[model samples]
Target: MTIAVLAVQGAFIEHEKKLEHLGADCIELRRAEDLNQHYDGIVLPGGESTVQGKLMKELGMFDIIKSQIKNSMPVLATCAGMILLADKLEAESKVHLQTIPMTVKRNAYGRQLGSFHTNATIKGIGEVPMTFIRAPYVSQVSDEVEILSVVEERIVAVRYQKQIALAFHPELDNDLRIHEMFLSLCK
Candidate 1:
């Protein structure tokens, strides 16, 4: 299966490598026409949400990706990607795709110095390594969103339908379970 990793901004390379290691053909979606290709799933990597959101709009990729997600295409969104999917963004006024029914705080962990690494339990996925770099945490989730993982009493990972939103960077770790889990959803 071919997976489209958003290369507009952030750590798309890590995600692309992870998927390739998992035997999935990975494609870097650098432009709107890339979205026209037949792909099994999409991966929104960790990066600057504000910049990514802006570029997607100016480049005309935002609406197409949003429509695909709404169609139930599996999506694995991490860090800034999670912010992109959140319906309500705290501390920030802009709402990007507004796909997931949740509220997130931008830089909830403070500045870059607040970045950390931890082991957390994700529902059904077991314990895994999580790396957070200027990450945002989900403060509120609607009834439809399932709480997947939490660290220090704060929600870190959640799943809404086929879209999995994570506040941490799973691509930074050696554990392939999270990527495998997302690929399974694509099937």
Candidate 2:
């Protein structure tokens, strides 16, 4: 299957490497026209949410990608990507894609100094390595949202329909089960 990795900004290259290692063809979505190509799924990597949001809008790709996710296209959003899909932000007024029915708290773990790594048990995947870098946790979720993983009693991962949002960067770890799970969803 072909997957589109948003390369506007963030750790997109890592996600691409993992997907390729899992035997999935990947396309770097650098511009608006890149969306025109067929992709079975999309990966929104960890990055600066505000910057990514602004760039997507400036590039005229925001609405189109939002529409695709709204149409049930499989999406794997991590860290700031989780912020993009969240319907609401705890302290921020601006919402990006707003496709997932959940609330997120950006930089809940503080700044770069707050970055950390740990092993957590994701509901379907068992215990796996999770790397959090200036991550955002889900403060609340609608009935349609399924909690997948929690760390320190904080909501770090959830699945809403075809969208899987996480506060940690799974790509940074050696584990490929998460990416495999996403590819399975794409299939």
Candidate 3:
């Protein structure tokens, strides 16, 4: 399968590496036109939400990604990517994507120093080691969304049909089960 990783500015390379390690073709997407190309799925890696949002708008990729999601493209968003996929966000008044029906709180896992790793039973992946780096938390999810994983009793991973939003960075871990699960979602 061909997977495109948003490369505006983030840990997108990590996602690309993971997908490549899984024996899948990976592409780095930088502009709105890049989205026009065919791909089985896309991954939005962990990064600074504000910076990514600005870059997406500056490069005119915000709308293209939204349109793709509307068409039921399988998308996996992690960390800052989760913020972009959320329908509502706290402390982010100007930059909000509102794509997924959920409320996200940026840096809910605390600052960079607060980053940690733990074992969580992800819905499909099972007891997987997850890395949370200045991650956000899903405060609430719409009825259509299904909870995939949680940390400290807060929703960390959720899926609305083919759209998967994860507050933690699955690409950072050596395990490729999550990426494999995403690949399975591809049409």
TM-score of 2: 0.99
> Which candidate do you rate higher for lDDT, 1 or 3?
1
Local accuracy of candidate 2 as per-residue lDDT tens digits, 113-187 = 999999999989999999999989999999989999999999999999999999999999999999999999999
State the lDDT of candidate 1 residue by residue for 1-187, as single tens digits. Answer: 9999999989999998989999999888888998889999999999999999999998889999999999999999999999999999987788999999999998999999999999989999899999999999999999999999989989999999999999999999999999999999999
Across 36-154, the per-residue lDDT of candidate 3 in tens digits comes to: 78798988889988898888889998888778888888998999999988988876665556778989998997899989999999997789988999989999988998999888999
Ranking by lDDT: 2, 1, 3
Model 3 residue 105 CA deviation (Å) reads: 0.7
Segments of candidate 1 deviating more than 4 angstroms: none
Candidate 2 residue 165 Cα shift, in angstroms, is: 0.4
Q: What is the lDDT of every predicted structure here?
A: 0.95, 0.96, 0.88
Off by over 4 Å in 3: none
lDDT of 3 at 174: 89
- Models 1 onward score TM values of 0.98, 0.99, 0.96
Candidate with best lDDT: 2
